[model samples]
Target chain A: MKAVQLKDIRKSYGQNPEVLKGINAAIEPGEFFVLVGPSGCGKSTMLRIIAGLEEVSEGELIIGSETANRLRPNERDLSMVFQNYALFPHLTVEQNIMFGLHVKKIAKSEQIKRCKEAAEMLGISDYLMRKPKELSGGQRQRVALARAIVTHAPICLMDEPLSNLDAKLRARMRSEIRQIQRKLGITMIYVTHDQTEAMTMADRMMILNHGEVQQVGKPLDIYNNPQNTFVASFIGSPPMNLTAAHVNKGKLQIANKWNIKVDGYQDGEVIIGVRPEAILPANEGLPAADVKVANVEVLGTETLVSFELEGNKQWIAKWPGQWSAEIGEILQVSVDHNKIELFDAVTGERLEKTHSKKVLEVVL
Target chain B: MSLPQAQQETQSFVKQRWLGNSRRFASLLEGLLYLLPSILLFTVFLFYPLMKTLYLSFFYSDAQGVPLSFAGFDHFVQLFSSSSFMTSMKATLLFVLYTVPPGIILALALALLANEKLRGIGFFRTIFSSTMGMSVAASSVIWMFMYNPAIGIANRFLTWAGLSEIQWLLDPGWALISVSIATIWMNTGFTFMILLGGLQNIDSQLYESAKIAGVSRFYSLRKITLPMLSPTLFFVITVSMINAFQTFGQIDILTKGGPMETTNVIVYAIYKDAFINYNVGSASAQAVLLFFGILIVTLIQFKLGERKVHYQ
Candidate 1:
């Protein structure tokens, strides 16, 4: 069952241009849907609109099959975990979680029962009596989650819920949130700018840029088959390298001299996109280009080698830590022809579907 | 370089920095110089007069002015025994009773009105607080003219509307009440400004959170806004009460303590005694009593405030 559906949602702030332009997505019951975008991309605003904190300038918002555009936040039966974990500063953890129920005038015994259940689920039963200021950031976030969960509302809206935590805690809470969502079976719409969070946690993801949905698909589908230059480059850590190259008759040309062949390209100038991991040391399949290695960043298990390709386009290749490479050394570089993506240079639309392991199923 | 020479150079650098910082400190001295003139003026005009009055409260100087003697408790005894002084004290207490609660209510009403998310609110706030710019003397004079029986606007309007013209200032029964009304009208704007500032200082997020929690606006205001604004309310009440104690200008200007001295407040009685009747020593005693009255009231207010003042 679809828990939340936003159709052509549009929002703008007072005569300014639209910040969220016709966003459409359906979050299924128990689905962890993440909206991943860079800063100022209207992700938070969209989340706020979903939480009914912001007015939707134009759209239909259906929560649990009920059209909820005119509903107040409390009336919509959706609980939001704010990025700052906006725990009521005056209320204890138990009170914060039970505030909504208390407002609804639930019986004292029932409210206490649910509060204790949520606290126990979140492993925060011991901290129930403590105020928000007394809790650590992780504890505060747990309380926020527990508050949202205690509503028993089918939908939970989380706006960058783990952004306030340190690295280890963020990872820990990400898994914790996933675990809680699974245990509760609540539809969670999580907003974040972190790709790793989206990749690891989202059942399906929406990538937005400049107030428009760039791509909406399963996490690995977006990782493997980005629809355009923006999604291709924005999703990965080092990001996919995009270079202006013409693909003709299964052959690729760069800098008017270097020619390499990849499968399935008809004609015209195209942008070749490849992730850092796709391009390995120049090997058998395609013609290799001699590129001077400018810098190398050594991670514990792997190293990122940044080098300038032809026409001054910078490409960073992720290599294993044991791989031999020195700065200023001109080394041969190649691409795995099957993994390469070709996009129209001017239009930024993918020219041909690069053959991949799995086909994305569109839920019409 | 040799060690001694290096040490000498280091010492000289340290000395330069110390002197440089000290020289930079001249700006503080310059600021003190600017304040010195005002401080001296306040000390002479305000504090010196206050200390002298306190000193005089312990003495008696009769008409001859030669056999001046220290009569410490005599002045207090004379003040307590005098019927007029007792009347003045009772009138002052009655004036406080008439003013404080209504002053807070009117100010809070105006402040809530001004603090609303309505159109032209800033203009409304400015109009409300504009009363603070008017002097008490001016307000009293204006109210006196308005309360005049024959031609005064209030009585004239009352008569025009076929209502009886009850004496506002002339009637001993109504004179203190009339003066208090004028005082509330005059000083309500200052308290409104204070409450408005307090209202604006409350975090709008608290209201939002309450709304999200499904809490009604009334409860949010009661639980969040009132507690948060208690400190400001405490301040407004404390200052208004002190101002109420000093409220003699309106009574003097409007009533002249007429029709059986119903409106003769402590300060007015003190003024009449010291300046008009030349009983400066007894007047000093009245002033001293007024000071203690204000001090006790303010101390009690602060003690109550300590319990109610929520930081956020």
Candidate 2:
């Protein structure tokens, strides 16, 4: 296993605006690092740069204590699984798996041995003689994985390899891939736009938006302690609810309707973030506000209730049991003070926590 | 009432069956209507002439190509024993061998070169495929001059190198070879264009993955590009072979089956027998033999080559 280090990586095409602007990351050896973002966020570009398929305009790429910026893709000593599962159509499954082995001129018997082992590990041994087109999408994905595995490269790069499969197959392959990566101890740099995959599979994940890293940490750490409003809104399902508010002299005013006592902070405009699951039905112990429901989605085991704050900003609260809340009906919701996250309104940076621990009193 | 009800049901069942049959017949008629133009053209131009040739091959024919008397396979027996006919067969086989492999290989090489992602490659592609636009008669005329001993560029180059100039077209030993060279050049443009198209259609990601596997360029070409291009290569080989066997235009323009019949390929020989010598029976026999020979060769090619072709 090899550790990959990137210092200030930047990329651009000709005179166009930069695609990746000054990315800095150090991936530990044998770490399952995931790069997650929405489309056009440059995550795939970063992975390609590490694979040596693309050049870094300005950066220092160190792979296992050696600089790799000038190395050819083949010389990088890494294997990659493309998004489309780029298997050679003319070759059978066995040949595709042994392509790298053949290129390295390995012994004939050893090549067969490795190929068979990978095929069996992937549970695709029966498909050795079948062409890629004859297999289903999920089977082809296994073949692509087997091809990468037989090489035994220290690091493996995957560019959204599971995006092509159906949802059920994708779910199955997700765990399968994770198991293989762990068993082989290959340092994996995976790129995906799916947040669920990152949250579940990554030992450490980096969140990117518009060519900049928002946050990088363990999935739960980043999820619970998002650094900025972007990270807060992007990391969770239905995302966090962010709305404009004002703070003055230890008092918080939201939509000019509810005021809550918040001690030990300067008075200024702030954006408050709350996870959907943190919002609950109003109770006596918590600060509560009366609001009209805008939408209600019953998901059998749980329900999602959405209400509009000031300026028509939609905020969703995930409730534990099915709720038959009718849209346009008045309902009362409460938010725990400790669960609320505050960011600077203009800069969107998270504000520091207050030292005082007084219960907040809301006057509606 | 029961009898009338049963009778009425039977009448409706019979009507439904008749309707289904008429619908099928209508569709068959519509299909035939769609095929009418091509069928008429083929019968008038291809089928009728083919049948007439088969008939004439078994009889002695007059100068006007009217049958005189039943010869009872005399023309076939005579062709098998004739030394000139044997020479024509030998020349045709030699011409096919010289032209098909060289033509396909040259076109493929050019295709591989032009497939590179280089700047200003469009100009080279245009130049390479420009020969496809020229008519056979025109290109053959140009080659005729180039093969001229005194004024030809070929002889000029040989003489410039201090080597003695040999006749290109007039020499009996060189006639077939000269014609083969010109044919390869003329046929290359179409073949190159097709192979290049096939090359372009390959998914570029395949090469990227191969590169990541650390395969050399030549190995990738052999293992990846060649197998992927097998279908197109098979097509080009079959077409080129058929074309080589039936070559007539360049021979008529350049060699005229002259210089002791070194370039007397089957089609040209048949043309001379029928038109110049007015030996219609012999020409018909040769034409029939050429048709069957081409058919058997094509069948053999399909049997041997298709198993290796990767269709996808």
Candidate 3:
């Protein structure tokens, strides 16, 4: 296993703006590190730079203990699984798995042994004689995984390897990949645009937006304490609800209706973030107001109710169990005082909470 | 009342069946109408000549190319026994061997080079494929001048290299090889363009994956590039072989089946017999044989070669 460190990594095309502007992260050895972002956010470009497929405009890439900026992709002693599987369409699964071994001139017996082991690990042993076109999408993904693992490279890079699979298959492959990474103990740098993949599969995840790192930490840590509004809104399923508000003299005002005392925040316009699950019905938490429901979606075991706040901001609350309310009907809702997050409205940076002193009141 | 009603229904059902049949026939006629133009052209140009050649091969013909009497496979038997015909077959086979493999290999090499993503690559691509735009007659004339024994660039280069300048197109031993060289040069352009297209169609991620696996350039070319390019290579080989077998222009322009008939390929031999010597029966026989030879060769290629072609 090898640790990879990127210091001030920057990339740009000729006379164009930088796609990755000064990204820095140290991926520990044997860790499942994922670079998650939206499309065109330079996540794939960063992966390619680390794979040496793209030139780094400015950075120091240290693989293991050596500076590897000048190394060719082949000399990097790594394996990469492309998004399209990249299997030799002419070669059978067995040959595809053995290709790297053949290139490295391993012994024939050893190559076969490694190939068989990888095939069995990926549950693709039955397809060893079949070409990639003959395999289904999920099976082809397995073959690509087998090809990468059979090489026994210390580092493996994957570029959205599960994006092409269906939902159920993607979920299955997610755990399968995590298990394989654990079993092989290889340093994995996986790039994905799906926040759920990064949240579930990564040992440590880095959330990026607009070519800059928003936050990097353990999944749960980043979820509990997002560094900025982008990370907050991006990490959750329904996403954190962000609405315009203001704080004057350490008291928060929402739509000029509710005022909650959130200590240590200065008097300025702010955005408050609350997870969909954090909002409760009026009887369960501190009652804020009875707002007219904009929409209600009963999802059998749960419900998602949307309420239109001031400035036409739609705030959705995920409630446990089925709860139905007519559109435009008044529904009493409340906010969890400790769950509210504060961020600067202009810069979107999270305001640090100094002390736990929350007092809620409705100014209506 | 019941009997009259039943009869009326039966009459209407019969009319409906007739209408359905006529509709089917009308559709068949419409399909035939759409295919009439191509069918007429093929019958006049391809099918009729083919049948006529096969028919004339079994008869003796007059100088006006009219059949006189049934020869009953005597021409085929004579051709099989004739040493000059045997030499023509050998020359044609040798020409195919000389042209197809080397021509394809050279084109493949040039295509691989041109497939690289570099600045000004379009210029090189245009230069490499320029020969394809030149007409065969024109290129063959150029080769005719170049193969001139006394004043041609070929002999001058030989003399400059301190080697003796021998007759190129006039020499019986060197005539076929000289023509094969010219044919390869003229055919490379088409082959290169096709192979380059095939090379471009390959997904570049495969190479990047190979690169990460620490494969050398030659290893990747052997394992990835060759297998991916097999389909195009097979096509080029088949076409170049057929073209080499049917080569006539350069031989007509430069060698003219002269210098002991060493460069007399089957097609040129057939032309000479039919038009020059007016031996229509034997020329038709030769033409028929050439057709079957090409057919069998192509069938064999499809049988064996297609099994290895990797179509992705």
* Best candidate according to TM-score: 3
Tell me the whole-model lDDT of each prediction, alpha carbons only: 0.84, 0.92, 0.90
Model 1 C-alpha lDDT per residue in residues B151-210, reported as the tens digit of each score: 789899888899999799888898889888999899888999999999998776556656
Compute the DockQ of candidate 2: 0.62
Worst 10 residues of 1 chain A by lDDT: A355-364
Lowest summed lDDT across 10 adjacent residues in model 3 chain A is found at A355-364
Ranking by lDDT: 2, 3, 1
Ten residues in sequence with the least summed lDDT for candidate 3 chain B = B250-259
> Candidate 2: which pairs clash?
none
Candidates 1 and 2 compared by DockQ, better number = 2
Task: Please give, as one word, the docking class of candidate 2.
Answer: medium
> What is the per-residue lDDT of model 2 for residues A1-364, given as tens digits with 9 covering 90 to 100?
9999999999998899999999999999999999999999999999999998889999899999999999998888899999998898888999999986866778989999999999999999999999999999999999999999999899999999999889999999999999999999999999999999999899999999999998999999999899999999889998999988999887888886678778766789999888999888996476578888999999999999999776677889999888998899988888766688889999999988667666455555
* Candidate 1 residue lDDT tens string, A119-207: 99889999999978889989998998888887788788888989999999999999989998888788889999999999999999999
* Residue A131 local lDDT, model 3: 87
Minimal lDDT window, size 10, model 1 chain B: B59-68
Deviation in Å, model 3, residue A355 alpha carbon: 5.9
